[model samples]
Target: MEQTKEISALLQLIDDPDEEVFGAVSEKIVEYGKPIIPNLEDLWENTPNETIQSRIELIIHKLQFTDLAEDFRQWNVAGHFDLMVGSLLVAKFQYPDLSTAPVLHEIEKLRRNVWLELNNYLTPLEQIRIITGIIYGYYGLKGTEVSYTNINDFLLNKVLETKRGNQLSNGILYLIICDLLDIPVKAISIPKQFVLAFQKPGYSTEEADFASKIEFYIEPASGQVFSHKDIESYFKRISVPALPSYFKPLSNKKIIQYLLEELANCFDNDKEHYKKEELLKLANMLD
Candidate 1:
């Protein structure tokens, strides 16, 4: 096939990922090697559609990546976090087809709250302290044993004890804040680590976050990494113990379902079930 023809076909497969396309492109990139990268660059320059151009750049970057790959070992609970995230996204969020904007708005609100509480002067320990406090305040449910203590120990426990998939530690906070704040952040799924990038809200143009171009990273579920105390408090309302295995990002779309199911789960008693559903529905409308 001609080079331009191959590039056009490759562009079509960028956002798409099926066996035939992914395998063909992956094999071809490996075959053509780095020399074909300039063609990708040239195509990007000529592409008028900004989204397509950016996607082209990402394809180039991925093709060029020579990072180490993981063994996909399941020795511990660390790597299974994505499973929790996927499950929550599927089962908890009511599988909503909602816009990503509101979630981003929530992130902004959360960030401003954190900025108010800790300002920019917080040490790592202090930041953890404040985070734990907020998690407890917002998410603490009943009958749970998770604590808001040992904030730092739990945060770094995985990396400290296990592998160093990614070097940056505070990245979780950055992406969460960006999502909450309504920034144009997108996730890049990479082997062993998920990463994030940011852009302006309007599509077809770009204003990359923190002045960094082509931000890369791991995907974070909205509410994961809630400090121990926060996790405790979050589940405390429901009377369940901490199940790190179960926590994932919460969504407005699913919050109602969670609130309802939780009511059912907690109120086995007849009197509370009927009364709670009526009142909860009323309040949800307000929210």
Candidate 2:
């Protein structure tokens, strides 16, 4: 970061034509971590060759990604996994310089708006309707079907900024709000679908009857509500047996891992396949 003699030498050799030498230099530069980013940026600006600039950019990305991977490791080992923080870390994968304050502010605004409309006596259905109304109707957040071509749909910050996201990202946003409000809504593993369920008060999936514990199912994409019968029909359509494990609420860590796995699908091209590997590595870290 301070541009010591070693750092300077490494920066100079960043243009080395030998693949082995460049790779070695890149590894050492990445070891300096995020603090060394500004130096790399300055180097990129002054360098005339586009090839050298691309090399510098790759080094800078490695530095940021190295830092982000550690953050993911810490999040995995923490006593509690926070949904909002986990989602933000995934966003940082694509946007290293993302400002979290504005995202937090937007979330706070939505939370406060929904909170104001809530009361102690409201039924679970009423409370969910209020959240759905405020989020989809008042805030006008739009949910699109998941598409790997649109990477923005998988990011939390982008979702809040653009008011659009795919099913998984939208479901995560819904989970974060429900968590803050102390509601029992959770994302359940519904097989190729991102679905939320409203667990009845004092009901646990550990109970013998899995379906009975859920008051209703929610479609995160459009804030659409469904009954047990609807979910049954879905299982029948897919020809998959409805198992209790599918009804269990996903942990925050698992949800973020799923997000990363889904996000990796967006980078299947020749130039960006490394990103897919990196994202899958991050997803495996959560395991």
Candidate 3:
């Protein structure tokens, strides 16, 4: 009761003309964290002063960013290298209120649909075809080639909702569903593009010969399977010499870092300097 009363008193001073007093009050309110958000929101709704409303909004954003930073730190320490969780955390930077349950449910539905059609008798290519049919044909998810630079293309939740995304977002979704279905699809970070590789059966990532174990590459945007020759040709076309690291499957942590780098690029294009810096900091945490 006393804490609530104190919060109420602090809320009253949010409109104080003195800048130092308002800053002190804002600091105290922020210490209350996420639980104080609803109260701040209520105050914003009721207050007639635009300045106070802006201050309240800033306080809310600060608290949310604090929570996001802690979540990212914990995710890095846990060391499970969960791709879905990392992608969701990246999404949370843009959408602080985002929930992972619905996103997981959507991915699970795709996994279940693909799982029903898969069997030991089917070849790896056939399995990929089935998944492609379910995701691209039946579900109507497509590549956002025209709006590729849009920041929304990088957010998993928005991609799931819109059924359109750039290479990385769609590729991540494809990888997560394949993972859930126990398929051997892995993300391969090539120059200027994100693609997937089908690992040969019994090829373990722990093995030193992991790079040689990739059977073929799959382009998630178009469900097209291509060979090493095709990758070579692509490198030639782009005028960049191919490196061994480009063919290697990226760990989930590295995949998240790549996604963050892409997101920072998006923010930079939009001229959102602070957001770009924040994303870069989060990306470095994976290191």
Candidate 4:
């Protein structure tokens, strides 16, 4: 934005010792939206004091977050929510300046590799075998146990860059690729696990006979396939009932919402509590 005298005065008062005054200044600055981000960045560069620099950083983050929240709102209302785009938005929460081109390119490369091995004659299991082989075997995408301490594991871009992610992120990446390929895989509502289900032909999530819809269950973290018996054994071991709702396929929006809620947990510390709040707010928008 062209630096008006009012904006200049607000920038100058960013270092004000009074918290109430600074708060007022921040609200006014944020009202200018993202257009004023470059000016804030310039001010951050020239600022000397670490404390004041932190203040400027907070204001800048607020501006970016306000914009991001709007993006999430729009994603929710869109006729069809693209999983790749939704995941990238979560990545943008932490990496405000993230370049999506690299991420998209890498995903496209993986998609092409998988596509080469796929043919119309292949069975559903065969299709999954090919995808799992390319992604986990050839590409070496590793799935680690979920850890809130490792924030990158929850981000799609970082997951792709490092080739390692927890179950949720790896599962999400798996879903995104499947979506691009027009596969029938979906994330299910199984408790304590991020599992995918390969739906049978001529059946959808809304159909009756929940058990009949799924060809099999897949553990995305390891690309391990599970039979109905295996899933039954799991429920018995966990002492949880095998409820039909647990087998229902989760919508793409719900999957992203789960990601945001889990990502929010990584920011529970005193210094990052605001991040937790913002992430939860974004998650609620998906609801």
Full-model lDDT, candidate 4: 0.93
lDDT of 4 by residue, 49-163 (tens): 9999899899999999999999999999984888899999999999999999999999999999999889999999999999999999999999999999999999999999999
TM-scores of the candidates are 0.22, 0.98, 0.89, 0.98
Give stretches of model 4 more than 4 Å off: none
Model 1, 1-287: lDDT tens per residue?
Answer: 34777766765675454657765665666556556777777777877888667666545544443210011112112333332222222221221233445434544555676556765565444554454344334423111121222122112122122212121222343444444434444433222223344332343322323223322222232223323344345457667654422322333223323323333333345654543454244224323
C-alpha lDDT of all candidate models, in order: 0.39, 0.94, 0.85, 0.93
List ranges where model 1 is wrong by over 4 Å.
Answer: 1-96, 138-287
173-221, model 3: which lDDT tens digit per residue?
Answer: 9999988888999987788788899999787666765558888888887
lDDT of 2 by residue, 1-287 (tens): 69899989999999999999999999998888889999999999899999999999999889989999999999988848999999999999999999999999999999999999999999999999999999999999999988999999999999999999989999999999999999999999999998999998888656767677899999999999999999999999999999988988888889999999999999999999999999999999988
What is the lDDT for 160 in model 4?
96
Instruction: Identify the candidate with maximal lDDT.
Output: 2
Q: Candidate 1: deviation at residue 224, Å?
A: 14
Give candidate 4's error at residue 236 in angstroms.
0.6
Q: After superposition, how far is residue 201 of candidate 1 from its true place, in Å?
A: 32
Count the clashes in each prediction.
24, 0, 0, 0
